[model samples]
Target chain A: MEQIIDKYRGDSTAMIAILHDLNAAFRYLPREALEIVSDRLSVPLSYLYSAATFYRSFDLEPCGEHEIQVCLGTACHVRGSERILDALSRRLGIKPGETTADGKFTLKRVNCLGACALGPLVSIDQKHHGHLTIHQAERLLEAYKDEHD
Target chain B: MMIEVKINGKPAEVPAGTTILAAARSCGVNIPTLCHHEALEPFGACRLCLVAIDDAGRQSIVAACNYPLEHSGLVVETGTSAVWQARKMSLKLLLARCPGVKVLQDLAREWAVDTKDLLLTEDRGEECILCGRCVRVCREVIGKSAISFAFRGVERRVSAPFDQEPDACLGCTACAFVCPTGAVKVIEQNGRRLIAPWHSNLEQVACKECGRAVAPLKMLAHLRGLAGEENEQAGEGVFCSRCRRLKTAAAVTALPEVKFPGPFMIP
Candidate 1:
């Protein structure tokens, strides 16, 4: 954490970048870590929390080992991405934005991935899997689950 | 430099960069506003102060609080039908969101806005019209970015850090003092002050002279820090405003008198 703050030279303007680094390191912003950032940067905790919550990328809670983000953007929605998301949710036994009880997979509904051509897109562990059907998505989840086993 | 503008057919001269709202008010023209406060910057959140501006024949509707007068001889119509319709729509929307807020209700009554046709959502029984007054006051005036608007769109709300008790709140109640809808509630009881909206409960400091609750100890300390080291002794004693004034008066009266020459007589 000190290294992250040191990386930004504790500049207050690099707050978002610092938070991004912290998120990448810890997968979510821990309260203690945020407090350290606040103290080191001389920025208020409320302001940090506000920024953390405002951005869709930052996670406040501990995320799962595998993150599955389903695009719900205009093009993806028209191509029936909600059905894929619903299938994934049912199979994972967790709603969108929730991690599985085993902490293996976190299902997230994202607005866009900026790859509109790849309608009904899903990304797993930062790897985009586009033009998917429900069966293929479930199979992909099963593969990740098998890897966990 | 002063600029001349006509508001509702009445000529008014105001300083350059003065907002249409301020200029109209100086000339005895009333433009209704909700989110505007004299001390803070214009937020234009409520859209209640909408007015029609005819700038050299180009017509535009603007919120008067933040719209500065950039040019002279601009014609502003505060009571035009278009302005009235815009204000009425804004009121209707505000009423739908905060059905129980008396200020909105009164405005609706005066504007003859009928709530019968409003597409009502599930009433959250909320009075906070999201005017951003409390949030702005705490950030801009108090200089403690202790609380802020979190989330976006329908989920947006003024909240402390993680919705927990704000660690940096001074318990000054400045947020409550500036809130138009009485949404930010501050209650003092059992030697503690509770700022309800932010879930901040702070121990109140008692005055040294009369033992009255002065303010939150943290707030006094913050003020003392702001006052600097030279005024440390002055800031050490926790005295309410009334007691401080009385003490100053007593100190002034106890000063030694000195003889001086008579005014206009050198002898």
Candidate 2:
């Protein structure tokens, strides 16, 4: 936390950059880091949380080891992304904002990853899997699970 | 300098930089607003106050709350057919968002927006309209910013940082007072004051006169600090604002009446 704050020289304007670094380091914004930044930057923790929640980039909860992003943008929505999301939710037994109990996978829905050409896309740890059907999505999840085991 | 603007075809002069809502208000032209509060900055979030503005030949529908009356001879239409149509749709969406809210219901009744056919799911139990009043007041007025709007679009909500209890919160009930929907509930339980939705709890201060919980300790301390007084360990509990006001009035009334010399007195 100190190193992250030091990199930004504790300047208030670098809040977003600092949060991004903290999120990247811890996979989410830790409470301890937020408190430290609040004290160091003279900004209230409330303000930090506001910034975190206002922007879609930050997460407050502990993310799973593997991040799964399902795109629900307009193009993807029309292409049956909801079915893919439903399948994933059923298989994982967790909704869009929840992580697996084993901490193996975290499922999330994004507006768009700018891959509209390949609609109904899902990204596993930032690896794009485009034009996915429910069956294909289940297979991909199994592959990841088998790889993990 | 005053800016001459026509609201509903009635010419009115107002100070420059006044918003169309305020301008309409000056000329007694009522423009309904949900997100606009007098104490907080105007947030053009709720489109209930949308009005058609004609600047010379060009015209566009704009949020009356934030649009400034910078230029003179601006034609503002507050209750035009087009404006009412836009406002009706906005009211309908708001009605759907906060299904059972009586305030929205009242607005719907006035606007003739039918909520029977509107799309609604099982009650989400969320009453906040995301007007941003409580958020702005907490930040700008209280300077504590204990709560803020999180997430985007439909998932937007007011909560403490990270949905955790905010340590900096004074539990002043400013959010509860400013909330138009009464979503933020402040509960006093067993010497502890709790602010719901934000999940902030603070020590309660007892009123000196009635022994009732008056305010949170931190809020009292902040107010005392603002009054430029050092923290003194006073043994007696202080009277609440109501009690203090009553005591002052009693003391004033109990004062001896001294009549001034009259110019002429009847024998």
Candidate 3:
């Protein structure tokens, strides 16, 4: 596979931009891919590690295939959002930012999605679900239960 | 072969696969860190370790710990004003809730953050630093997802799967140690809850007056509820409801006591 170095072509100005795009797209810059870029452009490994670790958007770990992001925003508190989150935590048997024992689900929490209307929202992948009571959430999570697949 | 990065407009030779954070560390450039720990994998959830990367053709803040060195020639800026402000503000917000913990206060002092805005908004309850390290360690290292992150945003916490007290926790302090905020405190209270992961442990503090062991707080209230002014006068420290009622009745009524012994009578 070709390294993502063609985009940079020794142009340090363009190199950072390309890496950012790759990371934003994948949420984690592939280690091999990064090595290829570093080799082609002659950038130091220390710099790359530094850049990766210093930023908030990058992830050295693989992104969760199925992301369960709970909103812990301020408005969500007044709405008893903790109950919804707690219920999800129970049903999944994993806390936020953790994948299940089976590796099928990865739970995480975000501060705010700016979706105050959907206080206490839990989004699976890209699908957003909100306004969850424990009862409501149990029904919603039935989709993840074991099935004869 | 090595890659070249422009540091403050100077091209520098570096080894392959170096993140900006790693590079800065090697170069003795101090990039402030709060959530990033050397002993653990990169968890970008903190948002404090932001560095400007000239990637995607524009500069945006990305966590250096997780963002990789996928390019050779990138413009990176650390310790910028915007980055410091974001970290300071985040620390302030975290400190406002968990003032009981001293680490947050120390961090605030180190950063010289004296903001009244963070003080303006305070919420009651346990403070969770939201580092995700404890939650991650509890699962990844300990193999028991005994305690995990609950809630979202600032309201988030590292807790049992259901916030019902872990029915599976081995009473291990793994989660507690990695926790930047001491939000999750595990006391060796005996088996009282519906379910606990570990062996049943509970404390039964009884009523101080009746010697009846109830919950410690419950005993205090019960003693208060039964305490009468007469009990205060006699100074035996209040009695239970049954004893208090009997004492009050004994005091109110002129009891017909068939005296057995009197100092004034000769046997």
Candidate 4:
């Protein structure tokens, strides 16, 4: 953390990159890392948390090895994404923002992925699955489960 | 030199860079606004202050709070039918997001907006309007970035660090006072001051005379420092404003000159 803050010369404007690097390294922002950043950059902890919460990409909690993001954009909403999300939640036995008990998957709902043309999209580990239904979503989950099993 | 602009078919002269809303208000034209405040910088988040502007034959609708009167020969319209429709639509959307807010409901009623089938999420309670006023005041005025708007869109909220208790909060209640929605709350109980929604528990400073909690400890120290009062003097025991006034009155009356009836005191 000191090395990262020094690399940015402790500039507060590079907060986003600093947070991204921390997130990349830890898979989520830890409180200790945020405190170090705040102290090193002389930025308020509240501001750091605010920036972290403002962006959707930043996560404050531990996520599963395979992160699942369901698109809840306008297009997806119109194409029955809620039912797909409900199905995913039921199959994983965890709602959005919750990780599965086995630590295999974490379900999250995102606003938009900018792929509105392909309505009802899901992304697992940065892999986009577009034009999906509840059955297909469950199958995709099964595939991941089988791969891990 | 003042710039002359026509607002609502009336010519008005205002200083350069004055916002259209200010100019309209100067001309006694009332324009409804939700997010704009006189103390903070202009944040054109709310679309309720939208106005139609015609500059050099090109017309556009812009938020009047941030629109500057920098140009001459500009025609501004505040009460057009199109403006009314846009405001109504914006209010309807806000009504959908926050059906529990009385101010929003009043605005909706004024605009004759039907509140039928609004997308009110039962999980979301009546809370901050995300106008950024509390956050701005906390950071800009108080110099305490103790709270801010966390998350984005529907997930946006005013919170402290990770929504936990804020360490840098001075318990000034600036956020609560500046908040438009009355979402931020400050309550003192059992010698502890709590700023709700953020849940910042601050230590209270007990008044010297009455033993009542007068203010937050940090707030008292900060204000005393700002006023050039020494910490030792404050530590000696501070009185609340009311108690201080009463003590001063008692001391003045107890003065030797007052009892002896000096020449000035004698009728």
**Tens digits of per-residue lDDT for model 4 on B4-106?**
9999888999999999999999999989998888998889877999989999999999999998899789999998999988888888777666778889988
Among these predictions, the greatest lDDT belongs to 1
Instruction: Sum up the clashes in candidate 3.
Output: 60
**Interface RMSD for all numbered candidates:** 0.8, 1.4, 13.6, 0.9
Best by DockQ: 1
Worst 10 residues of 3 chain A by lDDT: A44-53
Q: CA lDDT of each candidate?
A: 0.90, 0.87, 0.62, 0.86
Error of 4 at A129 (Å): 6.2
Q: Tell me the tens digit of each residue's lDDT in model 1 across B1-267.
A: 988999999888899999999999998999999999999999999999999999999999999999999879899999989999999999988888888889988888888987888655557778888889988888899988899988877888899989999988989998989999989999998779999989999988888998888788788778777877443453357788999999999999999987776667745
Q: What is the per-residue lDDT of model 2 for residues B1-267, given as tens digits with 9 covering 90 to 100?
A: 888989988899999999999888877889998889999889998899999999997999999999999979999998889999999899888777888778888998888876677754456766989898889999889988777777777778888887878877988888889888888898889878988888888888787897777777777778778888664532246788899999999999999997989767787
- Could you tell me how far off, in angstroms, the CA of residue A97 lies in candidate 3 after the best superposition? 25
Which candidate would rank higher by lDDT, 2 or 3?
Answer: 2
Q: List DockQ, one per candidate, in order.
A: 0.76, 0.67, 0.02, 0.73
> Runs in model 4 with CA error above 4 Å?
A70-90, A111-123, A127-149, B105-125, B227-235, B255-267
Model 2: residues >4 Å from true position, as ranges? A86-94, A130-143, A146-148, B119-125, B188-192, B232-237, B241-267
| Worst 10-residue lDDT window, candidate 2 chain B | B229-238
**Candidate achieving higher TM-score, 2 or 3:** 2
Off by over 4 Å in 3: A1-149, B7-17, B123-125, B153-155, B186-267
Evaluate candidate 2 and give its CAPRI docking class based on DockQ. Answer: medium
Fnat of each prediction, in sequence: 0.90, 0.80, 0.00, 0.93
Residue A56 accuracy (lDDT) in model 1 = 72
